[model samples]
Target: MTPSPGRSYPILISVILVGLVALALGTQPIKPIMSNWPAALNIAAPDVLALPTAAPPAAISGAALITGVAQAQGEGETALEVYMAQSDVQEDVGEGQVRFTRRDVAGGALELLVLRLDEHTNIRVINADGATPGSDERGDTTWTDGQRHLRTVQEMTTAPYALRENSELLGAIAFGFHGEPRTANEGTVVIDGQVLRSNPGRATLCITHERRAEIGRFSSEDLARCAQAIGGGPVLLWDTLIANPDVATAEGEFLPFNPLGEDFVQLDWRKKIYNGRYPKTAAGIGLLESGESFLVLATSYDMTGIDLARQLRDMGCYAALGGDDDTSTQTVWRGQLTRARDVRPVPAAIGVYVRTQ
Candidate 1:
C-alpha cells in the first residue's frame, strides 16, 4: 500500500535521521546499500540467494565395497596409478575387509561387491551371485589367489570390457585393486539362471570380527599360572580360517548355507560340517592359584589383543593372547572340559583342536 505523502515525508526524514545516527555511532550497517544499492536499483535484480546442498554420506559405492582406503579401476586400466594417488588403499586393503560374489543377470551375469568399515563391522549383499559362477575357496595360501579371483568377478559385474586369454596385464590390474572388481564374459557366470543386482551401494561387502576375553568371564585353569582363550575356535576341518575383510559384516562369523541372523548371530555352520564349537569370538580361562584367579584372554585380529593381554597380566593373568592373525597362539581354553587329560603341558595355547565326544 502506498503511503500518503504527508506520512511518507516524515518516514523518509526518520530513516535519514536513523542513518545519520548510525554513522555517528560508527556502526555503518548500510554498507551494502551504499556500495551496491544504486547498481542494484538500476539493474532491477531480485534480492535472493540459492540454498546450498547437504553433504553426502562419507561412504560411497558404485558396485563393490571400498574398505579402509580403496579406489576402483575399470577394465583395461592400470590401477597402479590410482593406488599411488592415495595410499589409503594400502591401509584399507591391508587392514579392512571386502566381499565379492557373482550375480545372475538377464542376458548373462553380473558381480556383487561389498565393503566393510571399522573393526567389528558387517555388510550383507543380497542376490550376490549374478556376475560370475559361485565361488568356494580351496587350498592354503591359495586363498589369496581366490581373493584375486574376486576382482574378475567384480569386473564382470561392472565393466563393459573383457579379459584377454592369459592376460597378465588384466591380472595385475585386479591384484592392484584392494576391493576387487568383477565382470561377466568369464562364464557360467549365472547361478540358478537369475540376474542379480538388487542393491548397488546398499550391499554390504565386508565383515569385522572383534572378540574379547575377560578373566572373570569364563572357566578356570589348573596350571601353575597359565590360562588360554580363543576366538574362531573349533577351527573347520578341511576349511582353513583366514582373516577375511570381505563377506559382509559377519564374514568370519558365517559359513555358506548358514548365513548370519538379522541381528547378526553367526550361524554355527561348522557344527553342520564338523564336531566342535563353531566360530567363536573370545574365550577366557583363569589360572586358579591360592584361590586367586589369573585371567587369560584371546581374540581375533583385534589390535586391542596386546592391550588386553597386558591388562590381564597386570591383574595377575597367567596367560593371554596377542597377534594380528586369526590363528594366534594366545586364544585357548585349557582344562578337563577341553578333553586334554594332561592339561598342564598345554596351558597357554591358542588354536587348540578339540573333539566333542
Candidate 2:
C-alpha cells in the first residue's frame, strides 16, 4: 500500500494495460482497434449485400391440336378426319353416309361439330314458311318452329339430312336492314330437284341440274337452269375480292387500303349499320386454292367486310360468298344441333344430305 515511487509506477502501468485490453474486447470498435494494430496488417471490408434471383416460370401443356384433311385410302374407300384439342382421329366413312362430331377448329379456339358428305350428296332447302307450329295456313316460321321442322324431316326420311344452317332470306316479320331481302322475297325455291317454295329471292344456294352448287348473286336466267336454289348474300369473293365501291368512293370498286395493308379499312356502311363497330357473325362458302370447297361460319371480333375478306383469302379461299348471320346463325350436324348464343327464328335453311345408293 505504501511502496516506493518507481515500483508503484511500474505496477500502475501494468494495471492500465490490462484495463485497455478488457475494453478492446468488450467494445470491439474499428477505429480504436485499427489505431492499436500494426500498419502492415491488411483486411478486406465485407462485400455489399445482394438479393437472390427468382426462379423461371413453368411451361404450359395440354394445348389444342388439329388435323389435316384425310385422303381416300383406296378404291371405294373414303376417309373422314376429326380434329380436336387432344388429337386427330380418322374414320372410314361410307358412301351415302355422314360422320359428325364436336371438334376444334384448325388454328382456332372455337369448337364446332362439322358434317361431311360424299361427292354425290343430295342437299335440300327447308322453307320456314312450310313448317309453322299449330297452323295449317302456312304461318311464319319461328325458331321453335324451325326446330320442329328439322325434327319432322328427320322422322319422315330414313336418309336424313346431315347438316342444316340458316339461309340468307329474312322472315316476313323479322325487320332489319341486313336481313331484308335484297330482291323480291317472292321467288321459287327448289330443293334437291323438288320445288319447296314458289317465292322469289328464296334462292340462296343454287344447284344446277348437274348438282353443282353455286352461291352468289344469281339472275332469273340463272335460276331457270337450276334444279334447286335458296336465298342468301352480298358475294364476298368471286375468283377475286369483290370490291364494295360504297366502302370508299375514291377507291372505286377497290377495297380501301389500310395503313397496315394486311387488313381492310372500315367501310361507311359498316359504321352506319353496326353502330361504329361490333363483332359480326357470318356464314360463307369458299373455293380453295387446292380446288377443294369449304364452308365457313365465322364470328368476327369487331371486323368489317374487308377484314372478313382478307381473313378468307388468308384461309386459301379464292372465292367466297357470305350468307345470313347474327342470331340467325346456326349449325346442325347429325343429331346434335347448335344454335347461336342469341337465337332468332330464320325463314329458311340450307340442308346437306347424302344420296342413297
Candidate 3:
C-alpha cells in the first residue's frame, strides 16, 4: 500500500529532534538557588543569601555643614545629648571623638542650650533670610467698606529687622506667644547708645510676662514687671565708670557708657572725664557732658558698682552714686554723642547714672 501512508522517515526525524531538545532541558543543571547564584549577579540579596558582612556606615562628607544653633548644654561631657543640634545627628566630642571646633560668637562669647523639641531653631531666629518652609491654608471672610472678601495667605510678614537691630545684645531667641507667663528672662536692660551687632547662632532671646514679650527674640509686657521688680529708681552719677572711647566719638567725645538709661542723676561733682574709663576714679572723671539724655550702656551681667564709681572720679566729673538697681528701666530710648538738637551728650564713663522720670 504505499508503505503505510501515515508513517514516513521525515516524520520520524522530526519527532526525534523534539525529544532531544526536551531531554537536554530536563538534564540541564538547576540554577543554583539564588543563594547559589553567580557572584557577579547577586547585588541585592537579603541576609539569608548575603555573601559579605553588613555594609559600613554610609560615608558622610564635611562639605555638608549641618549648622543650627546648638541647643544642648555646654557641659562638655560626652553625654551625646548636649552636642546635638535641632536634627538627628549632633556634633560632639566623646572618648577620642572630636566635635566641631567651638569658636566665640565674637571675643568673650558664651553659648546657651535649650532641650525642648518643636522649638524654632536658632538659625530661624538670627537669619533675617529664613522663611517658613511649610504652608498654611485657612479660608477667612472679612467685610470692609461695605464689601465682603475671601483671603488665602500662607506666610505672614514677620519683623526681622527688629531682631537684626538687637542681635548683638541678644543672648538667645525665645518664641513670643500671647497669654503666657513671665517665664524666662523677660525685662529690658537699657544701655548707652552703644550700637550692638546682631549675629546669627550667638544671639539669645527670652520671652516675658506681657501677653507676649520676647527679649532679644521678642519682649512682651512681662518685661516691664521684671524691671519693676528690680527696684527701679533715679539714674546715679558715679565718677568711677567711663564710656568706651574706642567706640564712635563726636567733637572729641566718646559715647557715654549706658547712655540710654532713663533715670539719670549726676552724682559726680568733678568736671571732666574720658569716655572709656573703667570704675576707678583715681584721676578726674572723663566728662560725658555731651548733653545726650540716654547716654548709658547696658551690659549682659552686673559689674562692680563701687569700682565703677572710683573710676569716674579719676576722670574730671568727680562724684559717683550708689544706685545699683536704679540703672535698670522699662522704657527703650536712643542716645548719641552728637551735639544735635535730637541728639543728647552721653555722661562720662564712670558717670554711669539713671535718668528717673
Candidate 4:
C-alpha cells in the first residue's frame, strides 16, 4: 500500500528499538541478579557441609629428660668379662699382707710409700759399688796403727752411669764394700759397651744401654753391650718362682750357700767367706705387668729368699731382684729420711727417678 515516507520511517525505528530490549532480557538469567540480594530473598543458597583443612604435627620439647637405660644395658653385657680376664693374669692378693702407705716425698717426681712387711713378705737389693760413683764429696777417715797411719777419703755419691739418682737420691740401702781395694765383683760389669769388671757369677742384673733392667744368668758375650750391672747372690726369682731345691747346679750357676735358707749351719761360714749373712732389713726392686717399676723395703726383720719371692709374686711382680740390707738399709724417699738402727754410710746407691708427665 502507498504511504507517507516520514511516517513509515518513524514507525520502523520504534519497532527496531523494542526488539533490541526483548533480546537482552531473554539472554541473561534472573538468578544472577537475585544472587546479589540479601539472604532473606533465598534465590540460590550455598551447601550446608564445610570444606576439609590440614593441621600441624606435634613438636618435641627442648628440655626433655634422658633415661640412661640403654647405655647401662650395653655396659652390663660387655665390661664384666674383660675385667675378669685382666684379674686372672695380674696377681690379686685380696688385701696384701704388707700395707703400703703412700705419701708424697720431697725432691723427686716419684711418689713414696712406707712398706711394713709381715713374715710372708720379701724385698730386693741393689748395690752401688758396681756402678760409677756420684760427684758429691763426703768426708775422710784416718786410722792410726802404732807408728804407721792409713788415711781414707769417703765420698757421698750416686750411680754415675745411672744418672737418674744423682741429683735426686732414691737409694734405700748400702750394699757391698766401699774402701777395700779388691777386683770388682766376679762378674761381667759393662757400662756403655765398655767392660768395667769381668769375672764369673751365677746371676746378674743387666741394665741395657736403653735403660731396661733384666735379670738372669747371662753369658759374658750376651751382656757385653749392657750399660750397667749389679753382681751378687742366688737369683731369688727368675722367670718364675724358683724352688729352693732346683737351685743346685754342677756348673755352680747357683751359689750352694743360701743365707736365707732354714739351715743356719753355714751362717758364720757365709759371713766370713762371702761377707754376707741374714739381713735384719732388706730392699729390692720389681717389674709389674703394666711395665711400671716398684721398689720394696722390709725393715722390721730379715726376710728369707723364698718368702721374698712368694711375696713379690703375690704383689704382682713378674720379675724381681734383691738389693742390700741390714743396718745399711737407708732410704731417702722424696727427700724424707728413713734408716735402720745401724745407719752406715754407703759409697754409692741405686736411685730411681720418675719421668715427668
TM-score (C-alpha, index-matched) for candidate 1: 0.15
Q: Which residue ranges in model 2 land beyond 4 Å of their true spot? A: 1-119, 129-188, 194-204, 242-283, 286-304
Per residue, candidate 3 scores C-alpha lDDT tens digits across 1-357 of: 677656787788999999999999999964311111122123222212111122111221111121111111112222222323322222232321222211122122111111111111111221112211111121011111222211100011122322332222112112211011211111122112111111111112221122111111111222232211111111122212223323332112222332212212231321122222222111111222221111112221122332333222222232222211212111111221111112111111111111121
User: Ten consecutive residues with minimal summed lDDT in candidate 1?
Assistant: 168-177
- Expressed as tens digits, the lDDT of each residue in 45-80 for candidate 2 is 111112212111121111101011111111111111
Model 3 poorest ten-residue lDDT run: 148-157
Error of 1 at 32 (Å): 49
Give TM per candidate: 0.15, 0.45, 0.17, 0.43
How big is the positional error of residue 129 in model 1, measured in Å on the Cα after superposition? 32
Which candidate comes out best when scored by TM-score?
Answer: 2
Q: Report the C-alpha lDDT of model 4 over 189-224, residue by residue, as the tens digit.
A: 444465444322223455555444555434445556
Per-model lDDT: 0.21, 0.35, 0.21, 0.34
- On lDDT, the leading prediction is 2
Report lDDT (Cα) of residue 268, candidate 3: 39
Better of 1 and 4 by lDDT: 4
Clash count per candidate? 51, 11, 97, 9
Candidate 1, 147-250: lDDT as tens digits: 23322222222223332222211110010001113211111111121321111111011111221112111111111111221112221100111112122332
